[model samples]
Target: MRFFILILLFCCTFKGFSGDFSGTLNGAFTVHILLGTQEKAFNFGVSIFGTSTYKSTSVEGGININISPFFQKYGVYQGNFAGSMEFFGLIGYGKNANLLGSNVGLTRHTAFYDYTKTHNFFYGAGLVAVLNQATGNLKKFQNKQGGLILRFSDKQNSVAFNMVNDVNARPFSKSGTDKGNTARALISYTTIKNDELFGVGIGLDMFTPEADYGVAPHSHINSEEDTRLVLVNTKPYDDLFHLNLFSSFVYQNDDISFDGRFGVDNYKLGALVQNIIHDNFGLYPRFSWPVTQKGRFYSLLDFNVPFNTNFNE
Candidate 1:
């Protein structure tokens, strides 16, 4: 992991000093630390991030640590890649779900490469691996995934497709003999105008007797927060078929920007332990204004609601 980070830093430094380099370099660093006492127990949290970009290539690395008497968690991640004909890899480790009275530690590594000779066409492939270990045992619970992506776009319209296969196994428990193979496919289309964009997408997931789409690996890791979102869905559903449909739109101008999404799906919702599907909707809008040369003020609102009706049943 350190080697990969060093390579990325080296690339950025070399590019900045090269005589033939004509692109610009930009970077940012941020750090936050909080220490206090909650109910007579010590509590503390620390977060640090550093990012740098040269032309079309960028590098980002961050770490988050939270410690308290009742709970403790930490995570580290880094990514480096280019815009087109892209190549990047990410590795992360953190505490995940709890199983059988023991905390599960998750370590994940993801990588991908895309060939985008022209700005309108792209083809790519990606791979992901996740290792789960219990507190006091050396046993392994592993999930592996591979996927293919293709996209085509023009001035006003764009289309993209993705297909992935996932396999998971636990070799040290009573369910050691149980293994699962699942597959999923997603396709989306979008139309763009001067200041407006709209898109719709559908996804189909096929589950085996022991596998569920809710626990499948993501196509890529954009950030630590993205990975956390995926990890939150730990439930297993044996349903043979799962379908999802969604639409989204964005409208922005010099004054304000608005974006919202709505979706209906039969996939499992880990938060709602019920074994049913429903329609979900969300809306987010932001208003911003410049206060000073280097200062800006913004107000944002996010709303989400779920319907009780079983739309997919």
Candidate 2:
């Protein structure tokens, strides 16, 4: 278990996308902190939240503020609107410089008229932080950017599928012309035998249009994009043991993206596994070597705690 935890820490330094989101709804609130370097593999977003519902209605939101190598503040919200429908939004702002700002967006979801089962589609679009490269991790979150998301999920049986798409901007990227876009898809299956007895999930994420940090006043975006795919899963062998796995697919170009071009070219396959000894508290021991890319490999101990209850659980 410690081995896989070390690999997650070592891999995070190479290059990837991460978002820490949390918020509240109605009389209760929720929080989620998601950090990942691979495309879709081994991505766990924490949710510590609460909410109150009465008179045939509901509403809620979640956000998280993370202090890391770079300053970041992000959030996500969802609830009911009109009647038999739902609404959601994602927004945030961050600055490493001596500047401050604000931003906002909206998300919506409506369910099918199936009183016994939940069948619905989801869409999200909101403002996001456009970092300026100079900003360090110690800076506070600022609301000055916009982002959007769209997703659909339905649960009637033990198997369910979810697909999500999100896009944001980076003001420092090539004079702020290059927009960063991300796409994700996840399919999850639960067992009826024990509910938590055994379960598994698969996920994917792709990053396109390489984002740039304009170092020069006249810098412009260099057209380029890198792609990644991740596979994540969780299964319980017994009442006291659980098995987890994280894998990835990556592609980029180096030589072609040189001399003012998108300098990214490579390919990689990364996988790791862990055995949970105590739910949120567990050990992961794993290893990986980037193929066709120079991404580094390292190992670090991992610690996870629920600020509230486990949303995934």
Candidate 3:
């Protein structure tokens, strides 16, 4: 991860100052301090993010890279949006055993219309390709995922909805080529004054591996689903220095074995303070409890900085 991040930073620095785009580079290094029931430590190696945008439309393309040591993630994204339609893609590497395949690499491509006049409805569709870095072949391409985004607002209230789904495929026992299909839906409501917010969502993930697919001997995929509810109150103070009280509940169920079923419940209570002294900065403190496990708590502090502020203009 450190090597990859160094390479990415070198590339960004080169392009931002020397490239023909005549753009600016912006970035920040965050300090992470976490206090939890299981452990308490401070790690400044949390994240490094940088982005650069070119000024000329004739040679228009932008790049972004993010690296996180705590999560063992490195991703680079590049896109061109000179015309009415925008095209972008991302290639990422992660060390999460459960989330990644044996190769630990993933890719995604997206092409969507960029219309500024309309705001009530929008959508994006894309394809995901997963590769095994061990072999470095173009063999594992997953299903196509599509999503719908809706936003509605008036004088008194605002509402938003987002939906996403992926086609199902048979799971791979050894390589884990196709893990499963997924579907997610979310809706949230907020007052125009931004005093309170409420949200609800559900997600389904199903995995099924057939033994006849030349896969190694392994158990079939386990199907799981989760439902979540959230509420937040931000009526304490002014915009710059305000308190947000929030809570959430989640129910999860899964079928991994033929003998029986499994289920669990989770609960969380938290608070967030936004815009301490700069734009897009905040502090989040949370406490989480599980039905059958020990409860834990943590805090997260984040800061965001934009380098090329005139890209959209």
Candidate 4:
């Protein structure tokens, strides 16, 4: 857990920028090894979990978390929530579900799925609810809470479903609720780095949980419609010439479609040009890299802005 946090911090642009410290929707999943001491009794294991960092509109109208498969062989599915009551963080609370896996205990006498051995991968799921209210300013550490949730797991793993929660630092802070209850299912893909190829697959969006910072300062979701789609395309001609494209859509239920994430849909497209690759200017011809029989690490670097944001929405 600590290692993951360090990686997140290292990706930051640093302080003095007045960046958002606390958020309303936040979630994630991670892997865990059983033991690394020896091959005799030790083993390697993975963990899947998620939680909503915040959910409150005015009072925070938070929705459930959205979670899917990630990384390598990791499918996280859990429902949890946390949020502030006064938007500014005068009062806040958080509730997250517990995690379970195969033979999670160190006891040799107890066996997993036998109703013993503490924990295991084949086990079911559990729940844990919490509540906290802050007294002083949000910057100052001051909060408290108390709540309850309905969670259970049996000796035999039967139920197969996962939940995930996210944070909402600012209303509409994360336009992409990849997770959470805002929408049911989503499908997004990328062919090359520094490129835009995003799409969605909706299947279970009951009453998606999205925020509206407020029209006075901001604006709520699309009033007439309740659904929306986003598409992006980026083409960099060397370092100077670059192309960018973006498109969005919204509708009632069915009868709606847009460009796919892994391919072009033809809604938007953009580009930049330089004398040379980075010379800046001109219609220089660009060539493609030949297909190689070997495949290891394939990536394109963008010295201008190496990172693109589209987290667990």
TM-score of each: 0.31, 0.29, 0.27, 0.18
Better of 2 and 4 by lDDT: 2
For residues 1-313, write the lDDT of model 4, one tens digit per residue. Answer: 2332332342232222333332222222221121111101111122211222222211111111112111211011212222222111111232211111111111111111112222212222222111121121211111211111112233222222222222233333432321122111221111111212121221111111122223122222211222222111122111111111112111111111122112121101111111132225332222111111221221111011111112333
lDDT of each: 0.27, 0.21, 0.23, 0.19
Which regions of candidate 4 deviate over 4 angstroms? 1-151, 160-164, 167-313
What's the ranking of the predictions by lDDT, best on top?
A: 1, 3, 2, 4
Model 1, residue 308: distance off in Å is 35
Residue-wise lDDT of candidate 1 within 208-252, one digit each (tens)?
Answer: 233223454433321222221122122232221222233433342
Per-residue lDDT for 1-313 in model 3, tens only? 2333443344255343654432222222323332322113333321122222233221111122222223211011212111011111112211111100110101111101112212222111112222112111111212333344444433333344444434334331243322222233334443211222222222222211111233232321111112222112122111111111212111111211010111111121111111121124331211111212322332222222222122223
State model 2's lDDT: 0.21
Off by over 4 Å in 3: 1-144, 168-181, 190-212, 215-313
lDDT, candidate 4, equals 0.19
Candidate 3 residue pairs that clash: none
In angstroms, the error of model 4 at 212 is 9.1
Root-mean-square deviation of Cα positions for candidate 1 versus the true structure, in angstroms: 20.2
**lDDT by residue for model 2 (1-313), tens:** 2322232233223223233322122111212222322111111222111221222221122222222231121111111111101112221222101000000111111011112323322222222222222122201111122233322223322333434333233432333221122233434443212111123445443222222222212221111222222111111101111111222211112111000001111223222111111123432211111233443321111122222322222
Model 4 residue 202 distance off true place after TM-score fit, in angstroms: 12
